[model samples]
Target: MAIRMHAALRRCTWLLALGWLTSLPATAALPEDPFRSPMWEYNLARYLGADAAVRHSDTVVIKTPPFAEDATQVPLTVDLSAFPHEIKEVITWVDLNPVPHLFTLRPEAAEIRTVALNFRIQQASTVRAAVRDEQGGWHVGSVHVEAAGGGCTAPSATASNPDWADSFGQVRGALFSPVGGVTGTRLKVQVMHPMDSGMVGNIPRFNIETLELRQTANQQRLASMALSESASENPLFVFDLEHDAQQSGILLLLRDNGGNLIESRMGI
Candidate 1:
């Protein structure tokens, strides 16, 4: 019995070693590039999870500068008036932003279409804007924003928050405001989260794991940005009015990787 137990332990050890070997990066760089190769698989529709039937439609327009002088506060705009009842929602993403999809703003009605926002970029990167039409179709737009510093790995964690450390990956967030009326009426929704690259480290553990936003918050979600580390710090967002936002109902909600929710409410 003693010999059998020893053999079992040895076999387990070998398996663990092999698993680690497979996971280890080929190069021993301080911080490795998350992208393995150039011909990597990448499809925005599949990545953004629009739908199997959803085709790329050129129905939406994104407004932003061709280049940015400051990456921290790159301005962006999207007009919904061009879209009729077909616009489901409008979404934006800063490829280099620490948390791309800086925020997802959901409109209450198809009538309300224009939106303007500011996002921070960590470095020079491409920015994408997508629109979800009324029939559940998706339209996309792309731009490039340049910046000097990246917001990821920023020493901006709040010590009071519990999940601040693991917020490296994408986080799920929302902002809801009653447009013209309350409950079931006109409303706008937004999401806040980090699109972690999994290249960063946990200061203490020095370990890396798959960090991403869960589907629970994403499926019910109207739109999202597959962001990188180039996004800004404490992303701020806004959208046009559709429904009547009542007092105490206006708010921006966010949850870190551990599912702790933090909300900021506007008194209206």
Candidate 2:
């Protein structure tokens, strides 16, 4: 079994390297496919460091209006109905955001067939909401965020990031306010972060780290492995859950490459 595992690991590594070649367009000047499908990029393997694949779906709707005036506060929403069963996680990503992964939520108490939340858009580009079902299949929906900026590179509200050392959630001893009636509390948990991609060098030579949401009460995780660059800056994760009067829950998040951990408890 060890030998087979090693061989499989080597094969995966080889294929991952080839993914870069496959992503390049036939032309050097126009390397980026204007209509490139996010599902085809081997992102799960290349970025998230996992071998995740997605299945496209029209049922999934990535809600972003054609125009947004404020780059700092833009509303983004996602809705998928009668979605496939293979789905285990749902995520909304900005193709142009410095990091892309804005926020992702797992079905804490429900499958979360729909979501709605306000997000900061950094620029105009194709955004996507990708879902990984229980069966290990992926479903995705993309949208366009008009010209906006200031989100991807914003500094932390306070000085240095708290010494939570990867801890995530509300401020110390903060109470959780559960929302939603129809679908129970439509909870939207967010991690405070810049989600800085090392590629970003505003002045030059300075690099920002990647941020991500890592875990939840739900058995299935969002998009793929714990969150990563697939999200946007200061990721605001919107999701739904069943109202179990007898249940208490917490949202576990990892920051900067999914290493640090934090917990946000749900309020009654």
Give the number of the best model, judged by TM-score: 2
* Lowest summed lDDT window (length 10), candidate 2: 203-212
lDDT of 2 by residue, 1-268 (tens): 9999999999999999899899965521212334574543644444333545444577888777788775655677787656656346666666666566655555543445566655555667777777777766566676666665665454433224566335433333322345553434455565555554443455221211332222344523322224543334455655544344424444444434445444455443
lDDT of 1: 0.47
Please give the lDDT score at residue 102 for candidate 2: 57
TM-score of each: 0.49, 0.54
lDDT of 1 at 70: 61
> lDDT of each model, Cα atoms only?
0.47, 0.53
What tens digits encode model 1's per-residue C-alpha lDDT throughout 1-268?
Answer: 9999999999999999999999975632122213332211133433456232333334466677777666445677776656645555555666544455544545432134566655656666666666766566556655555556554454333333578555533324344545555332222333344433343465321211111211232222222222233333344444444333222234434544445555444333
Cα lDDT over the full model 2: 0.53
